[model samples]
Target: MKSNKATIHDIAAKLNITASTVSRALNDNPRISDETKKKVLKVAKQINYQPNHIASALRSGKSRLIGVIVPTANRNFFSSVIRGIEDHANILNYKIIISQSYDEYAKEVLNTEALINARVDGIIASLGKMTENFDHFHKVLDKGIPLVLFDRTADVLDVSHVILDDHLGAYQAVDHLIKNGCRRIVHFTSAQRINIYRERKRGYEDALKANGLEVDPALILYSNMQLEDGRRLTEETLQNKVHFDGIFSSSDYAAMGALQVLKENGIAVPGQVKLVGFGNEPFTSFSDPTITTVDQRSISMGKITAEMFFEILNNKGAELISKKTIIKPELIIRDSSK
Candidate 1:
């Protein structure tokens, strides 16, 4: 069917008036007469006219769009963050375009370029695991685009960053275990290359020293912070006959693995070997014996990140300072750690 779509020229020709006059009348300009405004509105509604947002944005020099880059959407933590960003953007009448890097450095660079080419007003990003190079981020900064980093951030970059107090959280977890009659405690951690894992390991070591306990290098097992890696580490710990009465893993999945291994070896959690994990993932509460963990306040982190990005966009002043917002971690006591 031929649609009766109307344009400004069509309205002008039909009313025997100039297109500029029709445009002014439709826009309710004070210079236009009330009779002409009514005539234009009636014809526009009858012909089902609609203004093009792309054309409007071109004239206004603003896209009203933001970009978000994350490692992956599969994890609950990241998904929650995205939801918070989206909610805040909705309130401000801005749209978000998202890209996933799958923890690959090259993919992250590509995604960064894509967002920049799309001309988004600002960007929010979480660095991937294998992302060691941050030159791509500098490009965004050089383009005068506001960027905020969350969760896994690059320390070398001077920009807005939001993350949890990982070191303190780990320290508190280990201290709690020690106070609860755990003398020989082993730490299951991830690769120390990442800042978060390094902080967590340092916290564990600091807690041991504060309690006058000798930090056993042999008790520290580095894993990949995955479920399978955790399971493998647990098996190795059991086979090696590591003399430890408790376990503190850097990830909840790894802690869950240790719990499973302990059960298989007839070791009682809290009764024989206590356990604590990080992230407070949902599965932590549903294990055979619920796992104790530290809550990262991911949702709140997301909301705050979005707010920061919007603030930067609203006031891109010369004195605008970059911020590093650290959200505190909460200790959750469950059956795994008494």
Candidate 2:
């Protein structure tokens, strides 16, 4: 029950013209008259003639495709970043192939190999949570393909990277809390596995030390950046009588968890315990007391990443310079941190 594939020969036969003439017309050849070209195109459309992408790619030596890898496509931040990349790629006549690694190192390796086999002209990647190795990325560099890193990037790779200014964002958040008469502040963060988290923690510590406040080891809580983990940590803090006046969480979801637990324990926000979080996720603004956080400028980062890739592709003589572009994060003040 399969339908036969239509070809240029079918159009040529119907028009009583040669296949070469049909090919030239379809290609918009100057020698072919407009009337003949229009007629050939109309017949081709009627017959549902389709061009082979593989054949065209082989002939031109350009796939006009870009590959993007992210930790999780389901997250709001990553999805927005993908949208930004797609918008820019579409304007430049390029298509994107997206892959998710699920924050696993092995899956990241597999995804990189698949993209290489597909022969993508460029790659944009945000490192997964468990990705600590850079061997897979070197394969793209070995092939002379342009690679751009965004968000969570590899410290070892010497490539173009676009990321938010994590340290300053954290500094501003903590500084604001201090100005609002919050002392004995606590930092709830993850393991120092990535630059963003590490830098944010450092910023928090530095702010406390600068303000002549004692940096209590018991107050710094380390947990997986998850809602359940946040809730568990908050509950533990209450059980142990930690006496924390303020908290700075590295994730909005975690902050939400902390808020719920504190409310259930009859603790007032901003009145008893002020809080701030990172990554101004959508839910931050809609929470009971709107959460204060940092905006990562994800869309602009994606556009700049696409722009960097095309710049390398267009430059014929000059070698592309590997550089890092840091986009500063903006602190969004809300009622939660008041």
> Which candidate achieves the best TM-score against the true structure?
2
- Backbone clashes in model 1: 0
lDDT of 1 by residue, 1-338 (tens): 97566678887888899988987886579999999999988887877777554554566656778889998887778888999999999998888898999988899999999988777888999988898888899999988889999988877999988988899999999999999989888888865767788889999999999999989999998877788877888888888877788899988888887787788879898799899999989998888788999998888988999999988888875668789999999999999888
TM-score of each: 0.84, 0.89
Per-residue CA lDDT of model 2 for 1-338, tens digit only, reads: 96599988899999999998998898789999999999999999999999654555666667778899998897788888898999999997899999999989999999999988777778899988787779999988888878889988877998888888888888888888898889978788886878878888988988887888877889888887788877889999999988888889988888889989989998999789998988889999998889998888888888888887778778724776787888888999999888
The residue pairs in collision within model 1 are none
Tell me the deviation in Å of residue 169 in model 2.
Answer: 0.5
